[model samples]
Target: MPTEPATYPGYRFPAAVIHHAIWLYHLFSLSLRDIELILAERGVVVSHESIRRWCLRFGTEFAAKLRKRRPRPGDTWHMDEVYLKINGELFYLWRAVDQHGVVLYILVQERRNATAAKRFFKRLLVGLKYKPRKIITDGLRSYGVAQREVLPGVRPRTSRYLNNRAENSHKPTRRRERQMQRFKSPEHAQWFLSAHAMIYGHFRPRRHLMTAGQYRRSRDQALRIWRQETCARVVE
Candidate 1:
């Protein structure tokens, strides 16, 4: 196992509680206040502000560690974009996922035009180590333009119903958005959602496709990986 960073030193609480709070915030539809209440009932009283600070500081760190441990992206990609409202204005959240629903990248932008599509493509290519063999997307003309420019050789398929994998991945974000009563700002949305995606992908196995025994095994493995990556000494 790769050594995680040194334990966080500034916190008064143990690493386990701190990590648990962060995990609950991202892994479920719990708001900061909701988490604070849950912890309060459990006899661990922490302010919601402290939970927010922990998420802001340590969420990215945990995401980076999990991303480092994830398997390579699958060869086929399904891409989609959804609109998110921030401060009464609409913005697009560009998301790409593989065939198995592993998220490739998510970007929040002011437009869903060709320029935005091209930027998302570039970001995915630069961040991921491998190029996709084929791409599936909705009948979005911008995807064609960006694909031709950034990945000229890959096969691109445009279909209305075939890209549901990418579209379905947005449900968690929607639920969380509702739980938190919408995002405060674009940067805030991006930071929280990106880290949320990483943590979600780690714990979420394809449960419908697995038998009970397999599901249990997969879940145990996911938890083990999370502990190893986050350097958490306690598992709840």
Candidate 2:
């Protein structure tokens, strides 16, 4: 079993219950209500709203911890934008994931224009502090401009097949969106996704490509990261 971080100062629920709810929410695509009911069967009688709060507060933190402890991303990046409908209007989610399929950055915008592209590029580069050797994107002019300004000298490749990795990455988000009906507001969408991306980044293994031993090691590493991030404590 995994241990909770000392920095948590102890939560309302046991670490096991908190961890179980989070894992179910992320791993099985279960909503807060669904997770609550699932736990109820196991003799934990937490409310759906409580589960929701747990996910909102601790999910991203756990994922951030996992990311900090994981291996660095590959030097190649894949960028793409997917349309999200909110209140019958269209919005865009610009995401950048590295060669190893680790999500490096994500931004929710009302448009997919040059300004939006520039903003996304800037956000993506802010924490990286290093340039990628190659960037893959579809034939979007905004991407071209942003790449020129933000990541100049790096090869920006646009082609049908090359950008498939980025396009495929949107599937999980799409599934979750469909399950939830639709995002109520941009803020809600951003908040949920920002947390969701980090959680998704943590437990997802390279199952199709890696061997059993490699996958097991990856899983263990992810768990270790979660423990360290959530358990960090400073002595008084």
TM-score of each: 0.94, 0.90
The 10-residue segment of model 1 with minimum total lDDT is: 1-10
State each model's CA lDDT, in order.
0.90, 0.81
| lDDT (10s digit) by residue, model 2, range 1-236 | 56443434556567667866887887667778888888999998999988888888887777766656667788889999999999999999999988878888788999999889999988777766578899999888999998898778999889878887788888889988988899899988888787788777678866989999999998898777765566544424
What digit string (tens of lDDT, one per residue) describes model 1 on residues 1-236? 56443446666677777888988988887889999999999999999999999999999999989988888888999999999999999999999999999987899999999999999999887766578899999998999999999999999999989999999999999998998889999999899889999998899989999999999999999888887777744322
Clashes of each: 0, 3
Q: TM-score for candidate 2, please give it.
A: 0.90
Model 2: colliding residue pairs: 5-230, 5-231, 6-231
Per TM-score, the best of the predicted structures is 1
